[model samples]
Target chain A: MEKKIAHFTIDNKECTATTGVSIINAARENGIFIPTLCHYEGVKPAGSCRVCTVKVNKRHLTACTTPVAEGMEIEVDTAELNDLRSSVIELLFTEGNHYCPACEKSGNCELQALAYRFGIMAPRFPYQFNERDVDASHPKIYHDHNRCILCKRCIRIIKDEKDLPAGSQGRSIFAFNQRAKKVKIKLDDRLGKELSDELAQKAMDICPVGSILVKETGFKTPIGQRKFDKEAISLDNSINLKAMKEAHHE
Target chain B: MSKPVIATTSLAGCFGCHMSFLDIDERILDLIELVEFNKSPIDDIKSFTKDCDIGLIEGGCCNTENIHILKEFRKKCKILVSFGECAIMGGLPAMRNDIPVKECLAEAYLSGPSTVNEEGILPNDEELPIILDKVYPCHEIVKMDYHLPGCPPRADLIWEVLHALILDVDIDLPYELIKYD
Candidate 1:
């Protein structure tokens, strides 16, 4: 059966998307940018970060989790929404010990990239400087609790594969331990021990911050060459390229 | 009209930010034409002869002396700029923020791998500045009018902001210039 199409107007621009497609994905298809941190491609939308928020008829909603409705008028790219997004990014910066200068994932980090996109000179909120732990017992990967934003990307993406004799199609190798501020990602000793090098790298890649890192692979990319270093974080690469050129000429 | 007087100091910094400031190269000549140095390490001025137009702070406060110097800059400078990651967010020295002050001193003076002091004595001189309970970003101690965030903020960024401030123009920092690392 053919999927029903949903027509929407984002920022007063016409857009058409299949019913049930997320507002964020639809906006992306329409060449509109909605910044996100917790929402990862090919993974379930948790609506945890609230960075991709959009206003619909005076109601605020997470674009990543909210499915598009026919004739829906989505309000994005407004000054109010941008400030809201920037504030969310600032809160993340303050709540966590994001010492970007010393972080191994400094240049490539998505959280840091978002801050740059928003021109956040400093977080308005005072730094919490929370004392978090580093779990390095696993030979393949180490989880730096200090940098974790509780986005749950590793927990959702890095799961046991199907077709193996163990045959647990989606058994999570990482799980949440404790609660509230004390909460952290706890690796399953049984499954985490059997993780391959490729999977270890995947876990690190899946993480938005410098929380999960592959052992001994720090600083592989030099400054000015890392991801998000030379380039601005944007859904539209052409726009960024134009900005880059203008900046270069100056 | 008198040129704007600018002051600079590194509290607990690695001096990398100051090095980046000098990376402006020949642009330094252009800068000198626009601004004058006052109470800055660059000129080795021991005290502020007069009030400064701008003060560029290069690091966070980790000791009582850092606080004193920061307060002095606040009182004397019309505009205070946190010039690097350290001054903006406590940078690397703040890594010990989680550990107790006593424990940090013990590790540095007693338990660290290389220690020749058989007597197990920690430095306690009257002249030495007392370490703060925790490293604090300069803004936490005093109002900072501007902040340039980077490991040692890009030299071009330093030059551009200075250029704009001296000329009384809007600081339009390009996207390529803003970086956290």
Candidate 2:
């Protein structure tokens, strides 16, 4: 028999079976949720958003990228983790143009929803509310680079999952003006509306923020009509990773 | 000087978002000491009146009633907030926009005779509405002042929106959103 792994209880739910998955994935598999500001199901793990930060044996680690272990004690929503999450959220508010009300991806925005999840009812930091360009170069998709959180999930998903050309991966403002060698190798699928439908699905689903929203379909549905509201599903976890990936791709 | 009168409402959604509000739980009581849910399905009251300092509207507008409700709130609420993804975009319902609206309806109400049977047709209740050929973000219909974007608006966002509204403080997003996807 294999070596037995330790167990953990989140609000009393036994989460020991997910010993091999990440903390966030484990939590998600077991119906536990950790707020994430910059994470997606279809993409590779990027621990950019500190919102999923959890106290694993009193040490802070991002649930999105951190794996689970046997007999490891973890606290997801403690005062320290909550404060750290809040600080991370406050920073995002200041960095980007997250004008929730006027923006298109308001109701179903991952960033906006996480704010509500972590109880960031108020933004303590100043809004770096600068005007960022909306790269609507592609007819089917519109990406507001200003709102990007630099999770690189898009780049990873395209390169790692879909096996697309490197250029199709997006450019991050943080890494936007990086070395020239990097700029030499980028994917640019400048196709027409023939691929609009497919592009729209991928872009919208990949964006954790309201950045790459689908055009023309804004506001047709109201906020109350979305999913994952009552229960928090930590995308960083692997327990439900299979289901989430299937649901995400579908 | 006046206190912010807050109200929340939902439309063509699973009500999971409205349920997300409950994630705050006891904190909501603390929130309510100042703000009020003028016309929330879960909160007290019916038929949203208007003129709220902050209005957190969840879900997207899928039917005539949804359109009416969105317009009414847009007019009445001083600060109209698109509370959830449905409010922001059409969320999953909008996914059907990829298909024909009629086909979507047929697939649900008619495709399967066993589920759609009885008197050849069970009268359609106005509330159990049909979906559109496409899904959209809320800004297409009305002007939104603040947005809490999420499939289910985050508990952090709920707390932060409330705090920003009440304390009148500014907020900057965390480094994570910028650094990651």
Candidate 2: segments with Cα more than 4 A from true spot: A1-4, A9-14, A159-196, A226-250, B1-181
lDDT of 2 by residue, B31-118 (tens): 8777666776766778766567777778777776787778888888878887775666565665455356666666666666557455
| Number of clashes recorded per candidate | 0, 102
TM-score to true structure, per model: 0.94, 0.50
> Which structure among the candidates has the greatest DockQ?
1
TM-score of 2: 0.50
- Residue B172 lDDT in candidate 1: 74
CAPRI verdict on model 2? incorrect
* Candidate 2 interface CA RMSD, Å: 12.1
Which has the greatest TM-score? 1
Residue A41's lDDT within candidate 1 is: 65
Pick by lDDT: which candidate is best? 1
B2, model 1: CA deviation in Å?
0.7
